[model samples]
Target: MTRKRINVGLIGLGTVGGGVARLLLEQQRRLSDYLGAELTLARAADRDPALAQGLDLPAGVLVADGAAVVADPQVDIVVELIGGLEPARAFVLAAIAGGKHVATANKALLAHHGREIFLAARQKGVGVAFEASVGGGIPLIRSLREGLAANDISHCLGILNGTCNFILSKMTAEGAAYADVLAQAQQEGYAEADPTFDVAGTDTAHKLAIIAALVTGRQPELNDISTEGITKIAPLDIQLAGEFGFKVKLLAVLRKVGQAVELRVHPTLVPLGHPMASVDGPFNALFVEGDWVGEVLLYGRGAGRRPTASAVVGDVLDLARDVLCGCPGRVPPLGSAAEPEGPLALAPLDQTVCKYYFRFAAQDKPGVLAAISAVLAEHRISIEAVIQKGREEAGPVPIVMLTHEANEAAVQRALARINALPFIAEDTMFIRVAG
Candidate 1:
């Protein structure tokens, strides 16, 4: 290792990529001072030349394309911040092939195609670091894989999506409708114009798949994760959840149940006193339960250019240290060199037994509540509580019920039967309860 400095070539000078550039430039002194090696910002590539105007990088530091950076023999690390499955994957694979350590913040690319990426890096004897993917600045991946390596993790419950959390929090605080709150979230830059990824739960599920794989050594099939978005969440549901001593949160649950793992993401009625219920806004929190550690909570600003860039820079520094030590891949992609024995069984959502909260808009006429209860009884679902006191006179009235622990399949069947009845004014809505 004749080189005393590690050169980092950066791809994408967009929001996050630009931040990474500033950090590498601004924190170069601190990083070199602390790590005892100069971490150099060698090349930055992006199609938009205008994006490089504000970066204040040297004349030749910015390039027109990523190939220049990936092909640069002087570059020791390639940082991919242009998120998506496409050219990013190509760039990363190319970097690994060139024996350059890689760092990225693309959760979707990792979730859908991580296994192949990890394998390629292993073969090339280079490292791939992605601490910025899951929780922006939470330091979650390294903490779990390294800090808590001694403990057998039992479950990980997380409020993982910032956009969804911001919308839900606004809806809860102002008692506003989902669409209105979503629009507000967009106006505030908390959500994208096309929020299907975050609000529809795909974003969170992708990150959870990474966390689950970190724990179980297998990325549970994304389809088997049973995703549900927050688009259906209403202010009325939020009020009802509050009345029921809970708060609605889009939660990602990954837990070990015996030999199987439960991977799920959905709008959950979290108990009011639970830490997750208090985590509102764009902030994120992960509650990890381990055998020896018992319980640990990681909470922080989970998104934004600065925070995410901090995570990316951390990965760059870590990889730089490895490079300086002449020991790349010191920490394997999934925290170990050995491959997982086999794919772990994923617990079916249908088989899950949990309490549920239901909201039914039924005709104000008589016999509706009894009919609904009868259908629930037919499915062997027993009600724990009900709120039928404020029945309106003119239109369909709201009927709320909290059920005792019931089979998910049974609940869905009962809901189907009840929704089909003529007296039911609209489709009944329900949220799984979590504590």
Candidate 2:
């Protein structure tokens, strides 16, 4: 019995690309047995060919030109681990045009130019599988595309950024400041030096945009997904949240609201009992609610070399099998045909209604609480609980409150009015309480 052979081309020799190469070489026999076809790492493209990746490749397999790898007649599939949107996008577009299947771990590229790429692949009649783009090795994208294909996904809540989760987990456990925890994360290599993309919720939003498109059948504009960072999450807020039986986590959320979709990323206060609250430290968790499946939780290492590489290789095998079986493009790029209509109408942030936790710095004087309550009353916002810490004679005192479900627009208006009060010492801090 002879097995069909499929050649693989990889771009980028960075951490993820190195892992993919190592896996392809080390597991060639195992993968061949599983796919019933020989999967060969025929060629790879990296800017620095002499970078010493510590992997043994056959002679002449390494190339300095990405376009050459894509244009290689022997390369059947292109696995792109070179992140970011620029040349990676160009390489993917070129591969699709040349009739090569693509497997990428770049969430940002897909988030920004998914429709264009998917449309090109569909028209070219080649498949684009991106299992590593979202939850690393959790297989969430494939689950949504195939496993839960029959159900209607209504809500998706995820702690998608490992850097932010690590910071939050350490902050909660040690009662440390955000800056201190972030510094520790950077020192531990859990966060980058700048760390803006991971901590600012941009990374989570990128993955969320992809997930929302898969679940809701409508791709949302990047700007429409309201994004907020964790820089403002203070240790005091984390302490107060514990008192209210909640934990602070940077969350990416998407839910269908009638004809609109509510997409946003921010620091959220999740109840202690919820699984998302328990997802701690450099780990990722996604909770999706389906009409028929109830609630599903997929958790794993969201990023890193080996885990992410495993996902990339899984996609390679998938495409390899499709090519071997002469069934390429049987599975659509993002689970279905790209919607003919435009982007989904994003539910305005101001119109959102949810429970909230608020922290206010106020003068340690009489009538301060009354003044704040009066403004909330004007907006019809009612308090569910209050925690007023000991007052300081000269320094402003902290007053915390948990509000019942209220309109986001009303809350913003109420906050503005309260901030204007003479007794209020500083701008108020608030986090939406996840339901």
Tens digits of per-residue lDDT, candidate 1, 286-327, equal 999989998899999999999999999999989988998889
lDDT of 2 by residue, 1-435 (tens): 887889999999899999999999999999989999989999988998765357898888899988889999999999888899989999999999999999999999999999899889988989999999998888999999999988988888999999999999999999999989889998999999999998889999999999988887767899889999999999999999999999999999887778778999999999999989889988998999999999999999998999999999999999988898898998997787655476767889998889999999998888999989999999999999999999646699899999999999999999999999898888999999897
* 10 residues in a row with least lDDT, candidate 2: 336-345
Full-model lDDT for every candidate:
0.91, 0.91
Best by lDDT: 2
User: How accurate locally is residue 22 in candidate 2, as Cα lDDT from 0 to 100?
Assistant: 92
lDDT of 2 at 350: 92
Number of colliding residue pairs in each model: 0, 0
Work out the TM-score per prediction. Answer: 0.97, 0.98
